[model samples]
Target chain A: MADVNRGSRPLSPHLQVYRLQIPMTTSILARITGNGLIVGSLVFVWWLVAAAAGPDYYAFVNGIVTSWLGLLVLAGSLWALWYHSLAGLRHLLWDSGHGLELATAERLGLAVVIGSVAATVVTLALLAWA
Target chain B: MEHLTDRKRAEGRGSARSGTLHHIAMMISAGALVILVPLFLIVVVPVIGAAHAEVAAHFARPFPALVAALTIVVAMHHFRGGVEMMIQDYWQGMTRKLAILAMILLSYGTAAAGLYAIARLAL
Candidate 1:
């Protein structure tokens, strides 16, 4: 049987204690954005190795990239880049002692997500036309 | 009061150095991205059209190669610092902390080897 009545223990000063603030929110968002960057880097590494191998390998990767699924991954990478870039800017501002207020932080966090999507769309459109 | 003053000074120095290193690493990472993204678009994208020789030649350019090298180095440094912080926060025992440190060292070492290979090829 499960111990349903187990008492809660004292916890460390984690995210739960205070109201959401910009610095904490930005830090959380940056971590999530880092996952995207990591995945994108792995894809890039695969592309690099494929390019270095030979035409056959290159063609294989090229085919995948030109496909719908590949395009989706490429789009994701672009979104990751923009998201991480905006998050980076947020960190830069925090380091400079600005944007510490709750309203500003929340506004910037929303902007980062929306702006990343916008940037990704623009990049994909340009790539498609070019 | 005297002891408290000494402790405050030590904390200040420690934080100041940490902040400076982080700022420098972030700036380098940002600058490298500026160079790398355009290089990817300009030189590398077209290489997808050309033969392997042409691609090799393009990478062999000193500027592009240098940019690649810098990007790799700065990226590894940034990753190492972030991993170290994560370890400090989550790892409890000394054994776990040491293990985390060892992992970080190995990661940086491997990255260094890979960057060296890329640089040598480019040069």
Candidate 2:
């Protein structure tokens, strides 16, 4: 018979009990940003579909996405994209048997955080220039 | 079951029959995105708030349309994989199956829509 009392088993202390660390925080951010990009992806799809539908529809979506609220989402997504990309590179490095030490992992985590913000700012600057 | 040794039974059953195929696919797609994403942003970002005609004309060009299409397809595929893992982590039983199914549909559906739209604009 299956263990019916499994639900009552003592559970280990979990996420809330531990103080946060850079690698842990960065790993969590990676999952968050990866999933969050879906929103931005859907919005961009809507923009394309609207454009395909008609000029008027395109104008409507274009207007909304260009609006301040939409811009905010875009900016967030831009940052998320950069962060996720850098996080992914870190994973790839780990996969190759590199950067597994705790100190190095923490440093990579910091780099992911700071680098993403810097990349977002530069991209925004370039967009403005263009 | 006792006839087989542990190593023999587990040899081909590491997390599924496909083994590391999913991981390999994700790595390949991630590498692809590293290229496709920057090219895509360069193509699409500048025309953010442009008028309809200008925006349409810009994307209607072959290079921009192609970049957008590639990014849409690759990104959605990657999203599908990532979301599947998330659902598996947090959901269970029928809910997990259904959610994964729904997301698979959504991911491919969006990819198809984007491709169709890009095709229309380009052609």
Candidate 3:
């Protein structure tokens, strides 16, 4: 007979069993930023294609990219670039087997976050000057 | 004990595969960018000019022209690899996953066609 009062069936235990590590955390963040960059790159592609197409298409894209909305997209792209770059460096270090220590991993993670913001600001400054 | 050992082996295999794929993708992207960015800056930018220039002028220099070609190729390859991984993560159903894969292929194809057209242009 079926148990009418059964609440749930046994499921695989995953989150409770695996402990988080630095490489895992960095990989997760990289995946997120990588996704962001994918979308942002598509936007860039559109702008480039439009520019290449002709003046009218170029103006249309230029109008959008120069607007507040465009600025937001640009900012997001910058963030993704910086995050991905730092994450790439971290992966490079890991490839060389240097940052496996927990403390070093944590420091690098923090640097990735901080450096991304700093780089973005510098890029924005350059864009403004241009 | 046997089950535990099997699970450990499976985990190890999975991690190694994932790490290898990641490394390969990163290497390709890094290598391509090394060739592409400079070309865009030196050749493509000057020819395109700040305000106005004929499309032909844009491809005036061979080095910049080659860079533009590499940029399209490398950027598309890098983008497709990243997007494929993302689709694998977020799409659970087989049909949806297949759809995403098709979309990625279509995108790469379009970019390739566009690049070919640009290359054929005398500018």
Judged by TM-score, which candidate is best? 2
**Could you give the C-alpha RMSD of every candidate to the true structure, in order shown?**
7.6, 3.9, 6.4
Docking class of 3: incorrect
Superposition error at A1 for model 2 (Å)? 8.5
DockQ order, best first, reads: 2, 3, 1
Per-residue lDDT, model 1, residue B10, is 56
The local distance difference test score of model 3 is 0.65
Candidate 2 vs candidate 3, lDDT winner = 2
Kindly report which residue stretches of model 2 are placed more than 4 angstroms away from their true locations once superposed. A1-4, B1-14
lDDT of each: 0.63, 0.89, 0.65
Q: Which of the two candidates, 1 or 3, achieves a greater TM-score against the reference? A: 3
Q: Rank the candidates by TM-score, best first.
A: 2, 3, 1
Please state the error at residue B45 of candidate 3 in Å: 8.6
Q: List model 1 lDDT by residue over B39-93, tens digit each.
A: 5544444443345566557667877556555655565566566555566556767
Ranking by lDDT: 2, 3, 1
Model 3 achieves a DockQ score of: 0.19
For candidate 2, give the DockQ: 0.43
Q: After aligning candidate 3 to the native by TM-score, how far in Å is the CA of A92 from where it should be?
A: 2.2
User: For model 3, how many clashes?
Assistant: 1
Which runs in model 3 stand beyond 4 Å of their true positions?
A1-9, A12-26, B1-26, B34-64, B113-122
* Candidate 2: clashing pairs of residues: none
